[model samples]
Target: MRMGRLRHAMVCSSNQNRSMEAHSLLKRHSFDVASYGTGREVKLPGPSLREPNVYPFGTPYKHMFDELRRKDPDLYKRNGILPMLKRNCSVKLAPQRWQDNAADGCFDVVLTFEEKVFDLVVQDLSNREHKLMKTVLIINMDVKDNHEEAAAGGKLALELCQELEAVDCWEDSIDDIVAAFEKTNNKKLLYNISFY
Candidate 1:
């Protein structure tokens, strides 16, 4: 049984894939969860990966989904993009940036699916340490951008959250949280689609 509520932030490069999946799953499990993207400019697959439609961080999901559906129906449908976008839209209106939540300081744990996003969030927090001087555990778990990989990552995140909830010292130290997460999820691989 959960002792109390925990606020979590899941982040990735585009916010449309891995983090969003984790966000949805986490929320379903009754955690106060938010998802963000670390990209300076939001990107979506167009006719090809070589040419993607770029938007800003707060761009509405509906608009981007419509654009993608219109721009490249074949690629979008083939890659199972609409279902993800629809699920995102059902949960939230737009994508948020890591900077957007820094001022609020609402999250107890922040999980990033990629190293780039992890570094960006760490640097962002480091620059404003005085203003936001709270113990927020940040973890970098290597999860791929594909759907299968994202679902697997979401499962890992849910398991970690459950494990952390049961730990008494999870909030005291980041090292303890990481150790518990790794120990609880030792059999699961970080990058591949396992435990799904």
Candidate 2:
């Protein structure tokens, strides 16, 4: 385990250094920043969800919520309204983003299928001081297009993602997620180090 962790650390370090080298280019470019760690213990859906929840329906707008309530009543009831709704809707709290609303901030990502519906989502995660985000990413399951519509979809997704938020479209592990970020033009290291 120690060796495994050491290996992870080294790979991460090397990748991070490469990212550092891109600082000048990134500054000139428009990179999206995000960090994620995978856990098979909670492999509810795809690669990386902006929130922590992993429900079966994946949308809070309708049928999914009722489905979850019926399927996992025990797990559903104990978690409470927001969490239950999130779980049923396949959403979860954006850790850093939610505090402000608790502390008097705003709303964030509510739906996942459209950008025009951005404001409907709540901004549960934000660090105005650093511009860190709520749902740092929105992992998807498709990667087959490099056309204008696809690029537009990416931009729209970016729009839905908070100003400093992020999104991914993969089914791999966190290492792949990090590598994707590093290899893309949208990789930003918003908060490399933290007090916690």
- Report lDDT (CA) for all predictions: 0.75, 0.27
Per-model TM values vs. the true structure: 0.85, 0.19
lDDT of 2: 0.27
23 in model 2: Cα distance from truth in Å? Answer: 28
Candidate 2 lDDT tens digits, 64-175: 3465456665654554432423422322222112121223321221212222112122222223343433322322312122233333434433432322233233122444
Per-residue lDDT over 1-196 for candidate 1, one digit per residue giving the tens place of the 0 to 100 score: 6566567888887658898999999888888888888777777666666987788988888987897788777788787887788888877899887776546655677888888787877777666645435566677798878899999999999988887777676655445556656776663223211010
Best by lDDT: 1
Best candidate, TM-score-wise? 1
Instruction: After the best TM-score superposition of candidate 2, give how far the Cα of residue 155 lies from its true spot, in angstroms.
Output: 29
Q: How far is candidate 1 from the true structure (C-alpha RMSD, Å)?
A: 5.4
lDDT of 2 at 159: 36
